[model samples]
Target chain A: MRLELQGVSHRYGDERAVEEVSLGVEAGELVGLLGPSGCGKTTLVQAIAGHVRPTAGRVLLRGEDVTDDPPETRSVGVVFQRSTLFPHMTVRENVAYGLTRQGTDRITACLDLVALDEQRAAYPAELSGGQRRRAELARALAPRPDILLLDEPLSALDRTLRDRLRDEIARIQRETGVTTLFVTHDQTDAMALADRLVILEAGRIAGVDRPRELYHSPPTRFVASFLGRSNSLTATVVGVDPPAVALGDTRVTTPELSGTEDLEPGATVTCHVRPEHIVLSNTGGATPADTGFPDSLRNAEEKLLTLAGEVTRVTDVGHHYDVTVQSETGTALLVETATAPPPPGASVTLGVARDSLTVFD
Target chain B: MNWTRDSRSGYSLERLLPVLLGGLVLVYFAVPFLAFFTRTGVDGVVSGLSTPEARRAIRNSLLTAPVSTAVATLLGVPLGYLLARSSFRGKRLVEAVVVLPLVVPPLVGGTMILTAVGRFTPVGSAAYSVGVPLTDSLVGVVLAQTFVAAPFVIVTARAGFGAVDERLEQASRSLGHGPLATFWHVSLPLAGRAILAGVVLTFARAIGEFGATRIVAYTPQTAPTRIGVEYRRAGIDAVVPLALALLVVTLVVLMTVLRLGQTPGVDPP
Candidate 1:
């Protein structure tokens, strides 16, 4: 492990900010700490940076116990949420600040790595917002620290600039191969940049996994809802052999049903599925025949839970439309599709693959 | 100063009130300086400066003020920084003590200093034994000026250090610079302009310090003390030129300090 936080807990007087968060980041791997604001994400970053000593627990850097070390003694480079570039210093000077030897060579290389060599002579105030972030990145990287901690590096920026800088940071992290711990509230940034994601809620680790796995098979409901758009429907178990659950009058069963080992028949549970995983087929307006089931729904040979519903709302969200389908039993399910959505009040069928439903009690 | 009215009426009291209220105080300050300048021309200033008494006073003021300012900068700046950045058991008490000199009447402050270091006191006797008398000497003048002026540096430097972002210090530390280095490289530079402003104000205060200096040291006359003595003996005509010389010197130094404060390289754009 390049960095390990062993049961790190921090308290600000009476209020507990972080409570026993233990995790490890592998060498050369970029691990993201994903959480909502005030979930102790920044506190954890501060702990690793040695700005805050945890009320309890140890911080290990390359297997060395650095719990009592001050920030200057620890070889940790940090980029705060806001630009911390020294206002009085030019980009080159700021980058050369931490080096004791070969200052100019390291400064030039780091500035070039961030593509900020052209603005090396400019003061922090002279650069644009993106350029300031880039300059800060160069300054942090110039020291060549063992571990890099980025605390919401791409926040408070416009969408285009944020995405561009996000990609730039990912590229630099890869190029340097520095063990990095990225902290962000934005799931998109975390999912796009991290090798593994540690999801925090209320200062506790809710789940830790690869981004895709965590999003699809979240260990907790907080992870499921917070990671992406999810539709949660209450269902009851009808059988255990094939792991069947009933959505009102409709029975759906699949061998891939999870969280069903301790569940008995007639047990109430909440099933969650991502909006994009549910396929919607329009059954109204100029159908060749009204057989009460669309051909697209009938032909699905996969274990599917089919629900007959009417389109209650449709929102065009740039690349995709979110069609909200209200079933006959009044269960609302959101389906995301790139195809043209049926108008509101039109009849539709929601086809949900059985494996996509993540049930929780 | 009349211009075309846009949103305002020509006779509106709202627009005129500020000028009227501010102009009253402005006239109060301007009338004295104006009368003195109109009464004494350049010839008078030259003749006054040529006098041995005026030259000695000028030399004395020039020598003591800078030393006092330096003393204030050296001692008060660290105290100011400590007040700004740290918290201790008696922080509030320390702040109050720092401000005590500023609020106390100069004569009372001089009397307070005498109580601690009078000739009969142990501190004064020790200094006297060492061939450095604490009162009735140039050292006394410096002590009086520093006692009166040091608070300005302490107050302004505190405010300057307060305005500096703590995150910048933290950033420097994380960049592999220790706390002392961070203070030298980041906090000191960031707060430089404010501390400089405080130093300038301290010098101005020190040069003009009279009441305390008069009580502490009467032998070596500063410009203000000499002006007071000369005025009593020879009336307004004799002192006008002296006062004008002092005014011109103070104004020149003030202007130079202000100019230095705004230097392009030192100050952030």
Candidate 2:
């Protein structure tokens, strides 16, 4: 592990800020600590940076115990959420500050990565918001630390600037191949920048996996709901014949249920599938492309498992329409489509892929 | 900007109130200087300035005030940073003690200094035993000046240090600079304007200081003290020219400091 936290817990007085959290980042990997505000991501980063000492556990950098080392000896590069550019110094001086070599212009070399070498002579006050952020990044990069920590670097930026900076960060990480930890509450930013996402909830690690895997096959209910729009159903197993569960209308069975260990007959389980996986249509379209009728049909013509539902609402979200389908038992689900969805009261079929359904016992 | 709105509704008696209040305050502040300059002719001012007593006092004030201010800065700046950045027990009490000189009258400060370091006291007796006298000396003036003016440095520098973003120091640390290096390279430079303002205020206040100096160093009369002595002997007319000269010198120092403080990067908070 390039940077590792082993059961690192921190407390301020009696309030437990961070619990027993353990995670590691491999060399040349970009891992994102994704969580909402007050989730202790910032405190964890501070502990890693040696600003806040952990009340319990050890911090290791490159397999060396650096738990007692101060930030200067730790040799970690950090880009705080706010641009902490030394406003009194020019961009060049700010970047050159970390380099101990005398009479060397390493400032230009670092600024080259952020593409702000041209603005090297400008003061921090003179630069735009994005320029300052880039300059700060350049300063942090100048020292060439093995581990880089970025705390919500793009949160303060506009969407367009964020996209640009996010891509720049990804490109820079690739070029440097430095083990990096990016902290952010925005899932999209984390998804765009990180090689792996560490989702945190209430100061504990909820899940850690590659971005796409976490989005699609979340192991926990929180992970599933948090990753994206989810349509979850609570049902009890009616029978183990082909592994079927009694949902609102029919005993829905998927081949993926075989992988479920505690999913015996009569077991209560929650099954969640993403909104995008669900297909809604009036006709009996049974395939992945064809959405079946909105009715409780146990046996379909194509032997496909379908659910009875009505189109409750259609919301236009710029590029697409979010079609919400509610089952007869008031279990609501969403389906996104580029085309307009059928109006409310129109019957639609909620399609589910065998692989998309994630059951939690 | 919007003339129609101003004519229709904005130009009311309420709007006239602020202007009237501001004009009255401005006139009140300006009237003394206006009268002083108008009363004293150029030749009379020059004649007053040409006096050996005036020259000596001016020279003494010029020599002593800056040294006092420098001493204040050297001691106060670090203390200010500590006050702003660090937490200690009874911090409120410490802060109050730091601002005590600012609140106390200059005469009271001089008397307080006398009580603590008078020839009869151990502090003064020890210094006297070392061949240095506390009262009726150039050093005495500086000591009195510093006591009254040091609070300005600490107050302004504290504010300046407080205004500096803590994240800047954190970033410096993450970039491998230690605490001292970070303070020198980032914190000090960022807080330069406020510290310079403090130093300037200290110098100005020190130069114009009188009641304390009169008690501590009556021999080496500063410009303000000299003006007081002249006012008693020959009345207001005798001291106005010297007062104008002192004011001109103060303005020059202020303008120079203002220019120096206005560096390219030192933007006002």
Candidate 3:
């Protein structure tokens, strides 16, 4: 582990901001701390950066305890949510600030790394928001710190600019190969950028796993719901042979229930699956193209638990359509599809793979 | 959309109330200056300013005010920064003490200063036993000016330092600078304009100081003291040139500081 937090907890007077967060980031791997607002993500990052000392526990940087070290000696680079670029200094000067030599070559190289060499002479206030963020990244990276921490780096940007900068950050991080710990509330950014994601809720670690693993099989209810647009359905166990449950009037067998061998018949459980994983098909359409799921998942139709419902709403969300279905039992299930959705009031079939289902008590 | 036309022609009661109220105060402030400039002819001003007493007073004011301002700045800036950034027991009490000179009447403050360091006191006699006298010399004028004006620097610089974003200091610290280095590089530079504004205000206040300077130093007359003496000896007309000179000096300093403060950068919050 390049950076490790050992049972780190912090309190602000009476309020616990971070509660016993223990995690590690591998060398050269990008790990994201994903959470909602005020979930202690920033506080955790601050602790690693030596900005705030944890009330209890230790922070180890490259096997050395840095819990008591000040931020100046920690060798941790941080790009804050707000651009902390010195408004008095030009981009060049800001980048060169942490360098021991104050060499122009090194400053130019860092500026070039962020593609901000052209704006080197401009002050922070003079640059556009994206440019300012890039300059701050360059400045933080210039010192060549042991680890990098990004706290909501792209949260303040507009959707278009955010996508552009997100890609830029990804490219920069890849090129630098610096061990990084990114903190953000945006699921898209975390999923796209991180090698692993740590879900935080109420100042505690909810779950930690690879993005796809966490999305597909979240260990906790909060992680399943917070990671993506998840449709959670209450189901009662009807059989234990293949582990089956009833959703409304429909019966479905989910493989995830196999983990709990002790579950008896009539026991109630929550089944979670992402909206995208729930395939939608317009039953009234003759062509199979109207089937929203890919051919691979469709061919394995027998492996799916199907539900019959009426389309309550169909929202066109650019690249895809978000279709809301109301099952016979009145349970609302959101389905994401690339194909055209059935109009509201049209009959539709929703199919979810048993393996993709995450069941929790 | 037609803001200009509305403001020019509408004159609604709501707008009229503020305009009337604000205009009264504006007129009251301007009238005295208007009368002063118009009543005292340019010849009277030039002749009065050229007099030996007036020249000495002008020289003396120029000498004492800047030194007093420098002394105030040197002593008050660190105290201001401390008051703004640090937490300690009696902080509120210290803040109150910083504002004491500002709230106290200058004559009463001068009397208070006398009790502490008057010629009869230990400090006063000690200084007198040496070559310098604390009460009757130019040092007394400086002491009086600093006592009255130091509060301005302390209060304004405190506000200035307080307005600096702590995050910027944190950023500086993260970039390998320690606390003191962060203060010097980030906090001080960001608070520069406000501190400069305070220094200018102190200078202006120090030069124009009258009541305390009168009580402390009577011989080495500052511009305001000279004006008072001229007014008593001759008339208001005799003092007009000296007053005009002081006004011009103050205006020039104010204008320069305003221009310096307008530089495009991170202003103190």
All candidates: CA RMSD in angstroms? 3.4, 3.6, 3.9
lDDT of 1 by residue, A199-269 (tens): 99988999999999999889888899999989988888888887788886667775545555888899988
TM-score of the candidate numbered 3?
Answer: 0.89
Model 1 chain B: ten consecutive residues of lowest lDDT = B260-269
Model 1 pairs whose backbones collide? none
TM-score of chain A of 3: 0.91
lDDT per residue (tens digit) for residues B1-269 in model 3: 33233666776677777899999999999999898878788888888888788999999998999899999999999999999989999999998999899999999888888888889999999999997998877899999999999999888899989998777788888899998898888888788888988998899999999988898887699999998888899887887799899999888877877777753456532
Q: Which pairs of residues collide in candidate 3?
A: none
List candidate 2 segments past 4 Å from native: A102-105, A237-244, A253-269, A283-306, B1-19
lDDT per residue for candidate 2 within A1-361, as digits (tens), equals 8999999999988988899999999999999999888999999999999999999999999899999999999989999999898877788888888888842557767788899989988889899889988898888888889899999999999999999999999998898888899999999998888899999988889999999989987868888888777888887786666666767655666555534665668778888888777656676343334554334433442234467678879899999888888876678888888767889888877766556778777
Q: In model 2 chain B, which range of ten residues has the least summed lDDT?
A: B1-10
- Candidate 3 residue lDDT tens string, A246-346: 77655667775835678999998888888988877776432234455457656454366677789999899899999899976678999988888779999
TM-score of each: 0.91, 0.91, 0.89
Q: Rank the candidates by TM-score, best first.
A: 1, 2, 3
In lDDT terms, how accurate is model 3?
Answer: 0.87
TM-score of each model's chain B: 0.90, 0.92, 0.91
**CA lDDT scores, all candidates in order:** 0.86, 0.85, 0.87
Q: Rank the candidates by DockQ, best first.
A: 2, 3, 1
